[model samples]
Target: MRKLIPLLLLVVHHFASAQTKDERVKIDSILSVYTGRSVDGKGLLQEAITLSQQSDDYLLGQLYFKLAEEHLATGAYDSAGKYYPLSLTPLEIAGDSTLLGEAYIGMGYVLYLKGDYTQSLNYNLKAEKIFRAAKANKLLGRALKRMAGVFIAMKDYGTSEKYLSEALTIAEEEFDTINIVRTLNTLSVIYDETGDFKKVDPILKRAIALAEAIHCIRCMAISYSQWGISLHFRGQYKEAIGKYRKEYELNKLEGLTFDQYFVYQNIAEAYFELQNLTLALAYSDSAMFLAKTENAPQFIHDSYKIQYKIYKAQNNLGKALAALEMKSQYVDTLFSQEKARMQEDMKVAYETEKKEQLITLLEKENTIKVLEAEQSKQLRLYLIVVVVLLVLAAGVLFSRYRLKQRTAKLLDAKNIDLQNLNQVKDRLFAIISHDLKSPLSSFHTVTSTLNQYYGQISQADIKKYLEKLEVASKSLEDQMKNLLEWSLHQISERKLSPEVFDLKEMAETLKSFFQLSLEVKRQNMYLEIEGSIPLETDREYVQTILRNLISNAIKFTPPEGTIWLRAKTAGAEIVIEIEDTGIGIASEDFSKLFTLEADKKSIGNSPEKGTGLGLVLVKEMIEKMGGTISLASELNKGTTFTLKMTGKQQKQAA
Candidate 1:
């Protein structure tokens, strides 16, 4: 019976192992969809997460880890933080040491981003231990590299260098091109920051070569950006701008919005160094815009400082002072002492209130004692006085207690308000930064080119350059006008003026406005109207909406892609759809497509510049005019935006 039992158990173990292998294949298939394309897979991800939960398998941990990675990529740190622990729990329970190590690495990344370097390091160290025990060199290199970043952040450069060197050695041995590129770039940064400029370029060159060999756009971008920084450090402003522009173009192709600010700011600084104040100012504006979108206080601060320099160089004292003021305000936000002072004052007030209350009670007690001594024969009178004093004291104490509670509540509310204000400030900064960049970049490119080629060029070439400059200047002017209108709409509540206008005529006007942009991309647009479907809506608001929508379509749609503006009337509604064969939005982005709360920006097919505030404004205007907006998109396929508004004057129907 015992021998039979042992045989049966062995058979069950073999079956379970086979079952796990089968499960892994299925899980891997699902994971491929996530890792393969830039499509919206939030729904698929959630469904997979549900299936993982139901199965109660080791795949649950992997699903959680992938979800966490997705969140981390999107800068959703809180969501990433929540999922990392779930990953760790299941991996540990299943005794999957390999995945368990990855979970630690995931947690470490989340904590690092949250600015908890010590805790992040702990997680990375735990991951290192697991990877080392399993002899997983690939993952061990990643953990070691992450640990290097933690140490760098903690200012232990020696330890960081050591870890980085170890990671580099492992990456080389494993022939891990990606890790090799990463390690090399990081080492270059460390050396550059430490003023070992001689060593930086060679390291960056190697990183770039490796990155290029693998066709890794992100790694190449990083290397080029670092190269620009090294040049900027040495006052080689023109060369630095060249490198920075290279980085910017690569990042744009990859739609890496988060990293663009650094390149933009570096370009601005380069122009500033060259004493090309106009171009410097423009690039500074661009940098500030990108920085604001990211809510990166440091970048915003740097941008303002550059702006101040530009203005000062141009002898624009007023603008320089304004820039200085703006820079100072951001500095205050970055390192504000006001909250600490407020807390200290509150503490002092509470203590003083308590002391005052105690002193009052003691005074009352002394008064009662005196009365009792003086009125020994008049015991009733003394008792009456004592009772009155006791009642008054009780009333005062109750009032003070209520007041203190209110004070505490008020302080708590104020703190919450302050936190919310900081968030708003960050978003507002992003918006301002974004709006300032497009026109600025356009202006800078033109002016810089003209300055470079002016006297040395033929008259014909000069004329061409002048014409380009004129076009750029006009574009900048239009951008400024749009900025003014946007600012006015946001700053005050204005009544909308609705009128019956020729929808076809309005479309023609918009077509003219975006003609240059369309020609640039060689995109085709067709306006298809079943009838003259004119509506009574705010003319300016409708124009704004149509302008932004059409512009966006043109921006996103690749060269030779088609766009259709179709409108029809159904029941009491005029339905309009802007359809584009464009690089469509990912499904995960749908939730915030029209939300002003999200600083959502993506590069267009033109690699065009946009603040992302336009869509937000469009939604607000539509809602105000009692209209609805909806979108249908398939990534790399197409996007369709549908707008429905109440039909105006049924009697005047075409």
Candidate 2:
């Protein structure tokens, strides 16, 4: 036993040494999973640098570029900008055009993060140059699309539209359905914000279909969510609630608490709109509770407003007044926090500026001393005043010549800038011209097909065609959403709709729509409805939650997989479960799947070619609805998702 103890101790020491190495591996694995977010990329790069010496060859320049990206994502502009140039130097030495393009993109992202919109465009253009030169049209299109987002953020909507349109064309030519969905969503948002409601509906509907077709549940869910919200804005509350309920159920199953939140929140509003005070009050409480729990200011604001109105309507004067008081308190808290952050930023800026000014003063003084000493030396040689004057005249001529040369160089650079601007303008025009044709063509085809085959086409054929059209239309709708979001983010013209409608039916209807596909895959997709679960929420928002989950199940499943969905009540909460016999999540990826704040994004498994922001949107929208969402999965086994929300459905279940 004594001899074994010594051996065990030695083993422990060796294991400890290897444990550090194991930790480094873990960090690398985490970063690889979170490739969607720029921040995760940077953290991974730093860890790599720390673990390996400078002499170690582990794609050092690539690491630096990723570091630049991470900094850019978190709004660290100066640091990103500095590192980008350094990274570019190494890439130039390597002469890898792909890497060079990546560096340019990094620089562009940093400039955008820094609020240097005009300069950011220049950097993106530089990236486009490299990508185009390499004949990487897909990458070039992506660059252009990113540039559009920047333009939208800068409130250059017209320009954004042009760029997105061009990008969409390229995506279509490449058969990139993911990019198609992306562009369509952006365009839908743009149209919505501009009050082009007539244009938004078809776009959103089509986007939902595409997401469904690709088995990208999150994308579909988002489209449904927007569809419901858009319907609510149009005063289609009944329809909106239906969508919200569906989203609520879907999100709950996925353990996407944020999305579940939105479904409940909106369900409450829909009930209120319909003058169902009891349901309305219940939903409002749920929404507020979720908002508070999630620490979401905007959703919280919405919850309070609904409560205030509910109290006032009930003629509870004391409660109504109290609600208003709470409103003020909430607003003040948000303002105070913003004010404090700004103050701190300003203080740091002032200190840095002061130090810089002092350094400049000292440098100028030292220069003056050098000039004085040189002057004394010249004075000692004053015996030749003629030589001194000649020397001065020559010095002045040389300085003048240099100034002329600098001016000419500046003019040359300006001309190049102007040429680049012209090229961008021309590209924008070309994109708009081509893009305008596609949707018009699609609409024309849809109308013509419907009209021409109204009597000749069989019911089954009509359904199939509609399904395809739905997918196509979603592509357009998605573009509009992206466009609008981009523009809104640019100008910060924020608005939150507090409307309600049932979302559950829409979700059920969607399942039926894809019945054929589900059957083809031999997956038994069943919904267990406990009751007439009505919710007051944006139907579109809720739809997004459901669609994402369902589609996600289908995507991950192999042939003959089984998917089960059920909704019931537990106390004050309504719970929905989605169990699937498909490729289940590993224990390690579980947290990454549900933690909305994580850098993780959709990878090869995600068909939508997304930036991985949709889940975050789903999570956020669900929370806004006042619900909770969760997920359980196992490797090669299957995944089960659960969603819980506070709403009138609880009473029905009881």
Candidate 3:
């Protein structure tokens, strides 16, 4: 035994020396990657993990922890979760509290992404406790920051801000530039969400400077992005674009494809707000391309939405419809993904419950065995009955809890539907009462005036009265048509039946239909057609759209004002424009023009009244035909309604 002890000591010493040497080499390699001296971070970490398996538990735990952190940084949450737990056992065996806490922190982040806020908080709190005891200020700050993130997700912004403030203080004290920048960004987000815009800018500015000082490209990019968002929210679009461009440059420099995609979207939005549609379209296309390359459905959907807005702004109705279709496709994909995730969560919960129930049964069986040996038969029987009763009670309570939760969800959805229906009902009634009644009363009054003064009135006066009657009747007719079409649209009863139609013929029809109204208003109507333009769309919808637009032009234009109906063929689409020299719309009202929310009425140059439904109906019909409409106007100058739709001739050409 004494001879064996000496031999074992020699073996132990050799193993210890080898472990120390391997650990040193592995750690150095990891540090090289982390410090940017090497580019193969993931590869090196994985190799380190493989090599450290035969080393001491402490070294192995550290390698596993580093790999998990690498996964976390890259957003591979499931892999990070797996490795984080793997790290914990070895770290516990080695009694390394610091690395164990780090594993807990990483696990907390994974749980947070999985929407397990309670578990995430528990893990973070455990990490915080360990770090506090160890006086690891840097690690403690990270744990606190993670806890703040959980509170942020829970929407406890006040509490999140408090935690973030403590984290920032610790980071500052330790001169941890990375943590300082991160905490500042998180703090700025809280302030931004709480509508304290005043504080966001300064914090983000400081964060950006610190990140720049540290030469942290990613950190600087994040700060710039946040600063751009702050400016965007404050309506400083030009400055926002500038900041987003800076972010784009930094992300591009770092080859951060995903980050560049988001930066492109931000720049597009800022340009869109500034009315720079060309640049907006360019940036949006870039974002869409990146989104497609990444195959990220959510990013694709968002990019399509941005493109839709840009196309709508440019009056490219065909492209806008295509963008909307793409957006809708991605929306459906996202919904399915969410549903699958929810089902997965449910499956996980069911498995957990089954395991728990099995554990309870085993525990009860052991308790019964003990009781049978140590107690009387009657006491053992009583314990068995009590345990069974408790199990039944728990089952019943769980069933009730699930039922209540389902009931609440159903009630909330139904309530939302009811509220939406009510809003539609109210708006419908307002349109009918105000718009329909005004024109009908005017028609009635004009006819009665003519009947009562027929004999007393002169021929010229009678002619003038007839013109007034004609105008009133026409206005009433258009209003009734719009109201009926809009009602059909509301109930989703409208369907498109596309047929080939001549654009010139449609223009002539509209001109004839609005001839009397235009003459009454003394507006010169011009028809400009480029060759033979054939549009493939629902004829009635096209006619209705044109009629309403021409009617608006006549109504808003002054006496002797000019109205032009222009149609031209552009590749596979026909572009139509209804231009009028009239009192133009204000830019502020442009957003509300095509929506049902445009309730405020505007009187035209002839003091003609409008229900604001004409443009709304026009817009809906345009979209129904897979087309787009856009408006350009300068107050008191003129307004142009531009429409674009696919042309049948192009299909023939192809």
Tens-digit lDDT track for model 1 on 51-141? 3432443676777777777767765565566567656755765678998898899889878986889889899999999999999999999
Stretches off by above 4 angstroms in model 2 are 1-44, 51-61, 64-120, 150-158, 266-280, 309-317, 324-654
Which regions of candidate 3 are displaced past 4 Å?
1-64, 252-258, 293-297, 312-317, 328-654
Query: Cα lDDT of all candidates, in order?
Result: 0.73, 0.64, 0.77
Local error of candidate 1 at 245, Å?
A: 3.2
The TM-score that candidate 2 achieves is 0.42
- For 1-654, candidate 2 gives per-residue lDDT tens digits of 233333423322332345446655765665567574543565556566444321212244566677767766765565566557646644664567888887888788777865778878898998898988898978888898889879778767788889889999999899887777877888776675566889887887777777778877777666667777766766789999887876776666557787777777778878887888888999889888888998877678778877877876776645754775566456556655544544443454345335534543543354444445567764343324323333433543454345346434644664565466445345333433553356557667877898987999899988877876765565455433432232222222223343455445765797897687687678778778865777654555556667667766775788898888787767867687778888676677665654323544343343333223344455655665577787878777888888777654211100
The lowest-lDDT stretch of 10 consecutive residues in candidate 1 is 3-12
- The positional error of residue 169 in candidate 2, measured at the CA in angstroms, is 1.8
Which scores higher on lDDT, 1 or 2?
Answer: 1
Ordered list by TM-score, greatest first: 3, 1, 2
Q: Model 3, 1-654: lDDT tens per residue?
A: 233333433332443545557677866676666742235666687666655543555676777688778767866565566567656755775678988998999899999997889999999999999999999999999999999999988989999989999999999999999999999999988887778998998899899999989899999999999999988877899999889989989988999977788888988989998999999889988998988898889999889887876776675655765776677567667656655654453454355346545644654565555556655865555465545535543853475357346534744664565566556556766787777787678778878988897889899988887777777777776776676567556645456766787879888877887787777667799999987777676787888888888888888888999999998877887889999999888888788778766554643344777777878888887776678999999889999999998764111100
Clashing pairs in 1: 40-587, 286-437, 288-433, 289-433, 289-434, 292-430, 293-430
lDDT of 3: 0.77
**Alpha-carbon shift of residue 103 in model 1 (angstroms):** 1.2
Task: Give the backbone clash total of model 1.
Answer: 7
